[model samples]
Target: MTDDLDTPVLDNHLHLDPRHGRGVDAVKDFVRLGGTHLLVVNKPSWHLGVEPDEPTDFRPVFEETLDAVAAANEVLPGRAWPVLGVHPGLISRLVDDRGFSPEDARDLMQGGIEVASEFVADGDALALKSGRPHYDVSDAVWAASNAVTRRAFELGAALDCAVQLHTEASEDLTDLAAAAEEVGLDPTRVVKHYAEGRLAGLTPSVMSEKDRLERAAESGEPFLMETDYVDDPEKPGMVLGPKTVPRRVRWLLEAGYDDAVRRAHVETPRAVYEIDTESTLNRDT
Candidate 1:
């Protein structure tokens, strides 16, 4: 299984949140998981106005970083790909980028993000001391969200590009279709991101995945695959912990699921992110 990991992989949900502090080397860490490609969620750029007043720098929104990430991936053969798109949800200036380390991150945002583990290393000790992240969202935020949505589609169309967007964004597929239609594109040309898993109270993600496939069949529109890299206790978020990406990938194989989906998530996403224009199969079919 470890041997298979080096064979190449795909990762769907890559947040190069300015808050996340990513750099060129993120390619190596991703490659460890066979991450040859990534769907860089610039979804956070939708925030309109209500930004934090604290002079603290907000990491460049995901939209602004996609070009760099894509270039970074291209530097490494079969190593990097970036799915450029804006994130959903209003971006609040006060929002904490990292799950628990916002304060430590405040000072670091202007520079860049370190490793995911570096901030969470203290685990329980830090968890015990952690505080909540807050923000001020005014009418400007709602306004920004609306504005960014239009702006992103306009920009993507002009660039002749597609972008990564949350599955929830599908609620407005009509609006998306309008944009594509306005630009003389088949609605299928738009790429929706992170369509998976059934979260309680959230609509079934499976339906969206199936919808994506059906749409592709009809439109020949190329859609990318992605994962949020959820920290599942059902599948615990295992850190390097004496294991390498290949080793952990092997463990995931043992945990059990569809082999095709697993391989696509790890291998195919990497390829797509790195801009390899291969056909995406309907493994579920």
Candidate 2:
């Protein structure tokens, strides 16, 4: 997938689980495909074989993600940013399997978000990843999850960074935007991961499939693209492949959607994450 252009190609949401998956090699796959940058989000704690009994246990998980970013930067320096946080799905596991009360689980997850915020504060990460469960959940569990999500928004506001959300799919994000506003976070700074379409108002890091990318480009609206590459060995490329973003960008460029590709890959990331992806990716080229 190598191309002549030095245009920035970023995958907004991705994971590299070394112990259980391809890890940095998967990152190499992306780099080989012309991907210039990645937002390497941490996997679920359980995926790392960590059953956290407390908040600090998440430190190793976050550290692993940071290490992966560091390694990836060695391949393409200044190309990957760490987005660390406790996965919202942990709430269900705590409440269902561990038999913790919903309130207690909320507190635990909030504490995990707090721990993640520390990494952001120290400049080890660029943003946070959080959201409520995407599957059917009890009312109390849902309430607690929302509380935890709010805490993530609050932390993001304090850190002056973005929060990438993994929630139930929907074209409209009115309630999600309101939650960010209520927590004093800019709604525009909240990135809806795995988004299927233009969210009513909030930013969407749409998964980088050809059709979806085409539609987003056709709309002429501000948005980002991603592979959401889980890097799981069993269900490899669960959401999309590591090479999907760059491969699709090549197709888009050939299709004469140059302006839209630039807007999505460089401009939108700069606007949302405050990172100059254009300069960052083009340097040394």
**Model 2 Cα lDDT, one tens digit per residue, 1-285:** 344356888889989887778888887787777878899999999988888888899999999999888888877633899999989899888988999999999998899889999999999899998898889999999999999899999999999999999999888988989999988899889999998747775898898877778888898888999888888999988888897888888999899999999888878998899999766765453
For residue 80, give model 1's deviation from the true position in Å: 2.1
lDDT, model 1, position 194: 41
| Candidate 2 colliding pairs | none
The CA lDDT at 4 in model 2 is: 36
Model 2 residue runs over 4 Å out of place are: 282-285
Best by TM-score: 2
TM-score of each: 0.45, 0.96
Candidate 2 TM-score versus the reference: 0.96
